[model samples]
Target: MDQTTSWGILAALAALIGGFLWEGGHWEGLIEKTALLIVFGGTFAAVAVSYPASRLRQIPESLKTVFRPAAPDVPARIDELVELATIARREGVLALENKIADHPDAFIRNGLQIVVDGTDPELSRQILEFEIDAVEQRMENQSKIFESAGGYAPTMGIIGTVMGLIHVLSNLADPGSLGPAIAVAFTATLYGVASANILYLPVASKIRIRAADSVQFMEMMLEGILAIQAGENPALVRKKLTAFMHTEEMSFARKKEESEDGTETEQTQTKRA
Candidate 1:
């Protein structure tokens, strides 16, 4: 699980509830189920109307993407690319046909297959680039689902509050119940605003961040695949892909290079010189 997101949500709720209790607010005052149904149900309905069910189905997977993000091993990817380049350069690109059929990443596997089939370099890059852009759009649209919910949540809350206030105003005979009724009505506003800020918007932001990282990782793969198709030197492939590495990836690359016995390829010779 993503500790940051989980802890962040917990801390926000703790501060809010703790502060409310500290201020002499009753715990029962915050548990307005009617208000919750209004905000959440209405917000969900609005979002369902806003996007087709086909897109809405992606919400569960998008949340999973945020919470259980795949940490791509950049250095490992570069190593694989370099190894593939070596084989393609030495044994000809077709030599990779029997190798990448079952490659882990669908992106890399499909890309290498295209190259093995002797697709033109320019056409290959276009095909891969198009795939990357399409993926980014799809991921971004998924985040927009939450963003739309966030946008609608507060309005739904307000509508609930208005409905509650309407009932409160109609039953003005009991002044004794006025205070509790008004407070209950306003819980809709609280639910709407709080859920938007603490949950929907935050989850949307997290999804976007994950999406960006996924696209960057795919771009790295794209570059590696293209370079391999071009018959670039394995050392050069490593050099090109290294620029895409984050700090932790750089550390991994250094460790892998250090463990080698100066005979893996020209990288050892390059390091020695």
Candidate 2:
């Protein structure tokens, strides 16, 4: 999976155990199942109660956000479209039919297919923009779900803590049981704080970043499609699309140039991240 996520979690757990060992010189099953059940179960139940079924179902994707790679750069994408445009100009848009299957980036492929099918430029732009908006909206919803869950987690933790305290107070006559009961009571709060900070919030941030990157990619494709429709020169279109590439994307182009002695610089890879 994602090494960052894996390593961060492993390191956190190792540090936690190491701290405990350093303090007490031994390890015990310090975690309490009942506390976890109350905190985690209650927080999840709260999310289910708060969000719609469709939104709740999208939570898994937010978790996957941690491991998912970022979207490919827009400049690199422009390069690919330039190649396709060159081919279409020399031959015809119909030649793209076979190339569509070989192409990467579903958005570009779909737009190319539309042009090849002779859709009017205005209608094609409208449809592509609509699809982009839909995808962006879905991603935003997923991010908001985690944000909402993060908002709810600490409250659930407090609830769990209070519930534990209630148990501890109930057993006031039994001094021998007070220590473990108090520790268990506070454990729920730890779960809530930890889950929200390390899990939900970070995932939501990643989703937002990915959504923005994807939007940029879509914007580039829109420009490429419109230029293609107007029968602009491929070199000109490449120049225009270059404006959309992030700084990091341009670095990939530099490496691509070095790999093939700049001759194959025109034939950039069509793959999208």
In model 2, the runs with Cα more than 4 Å from the true position are 15-17, 25-29, 70-79, 101-104, 254-273
- Candidate 1 regions exceeding 4 Å error are 258-273
RMSD of each: 2.8, 5.9
Q: In candidate 2, where is summed lDDT lowest over 10 consecutive residues?
A: 264-273
**In terms of lDDT, which candidate is strongest?**
1
Model 2, 1-273: lDDT tens digits are 668777876787687778877887454445778767877788788878888998888777766765766546555566678877888888878877887777867887888889889999899999999989998999999888888778888888888889999989987898998987888788888788878887777778878887887888888889998787677888678767867776777677556546644555545543321
Predictions in order: lDDT: 0.90, 0.79
Name every residue pair that clashes in candidate 2: none
Give the best candidate by TM-score.
1
